[model samples]
Target: MTYLEKWFDFNRRQKEIESLLEETIAQQSEQSLTLKEFYLLYYLDLAQEKSLRQIDLPDKLHLSPSAVSRMVARLEAKKLWST
Candidate 1:
């Protein structure tokens, strides 16, 4: 195969792998979450390596502190997160 052909093949396989992974995520139970829930979880994940406090999460997300608190409260009520 030519170099261009090999590059195309590699990119195609990478796309396929990415598709499969995305499909898996789409089929997950967690996918039931709303957009707000999804973004909240995503933010928490980004903060995972650091000392992320529940209070600071809202500022980082640029959401109102009360809004963030309410979100965390709801998630806690659902047992998805802990205080």
Candidate 2:
């Protein structure tokens, strides 16, 4: 094969390995998240973490605060969070 062709193959392989490594890490990350946690983290930006308030969550989710509280409590009980 030509030198150019060999170089192309090496570059392509490096890209493939990089892509595979990225994909594996992404999946590991995704596996660590949950649907409810997505909502919590969404609210938690880079600014701060707040106690999952009872009022706003219902309005935000279109579900009752009682329901949201129960779900949040379950998550807390499961050791999903600290504060």
> lDDT of candidate 2 vs native?
0.64
Q: Write the per-residue lDDT of candidate 1 for residues 1-83, one digit (tens) a residue.
A: 99999999999999897667566656885534545666677777777573358777776667888888888888887787775
Clash counts per candidate, in order, are 0, 0
Report the C-alpha lDDT of model 2 over 18-74, residue by residue, as the tens digit: 667656655866344444445554565433455555566677655677777776777
Give TM per candidate. Answer: 0.51, 0.44
Ten-residue stretch with the least lDDT total in model 2: 30-39
Model 2 off-target regions past 4 Å? 1-34, 46-52
Segments of candidate 1 deviating more than 4 angstroms: 1-27, 30-32, 49-51
- At residue 62, give the lDDT of candidate 2: 59
Q: Each candidate's lDDT (Cα)?
A: 0.73, 0.64
Top of the candidates by lDDT: 1
Q: Which one wins on TM-score?
A: 1
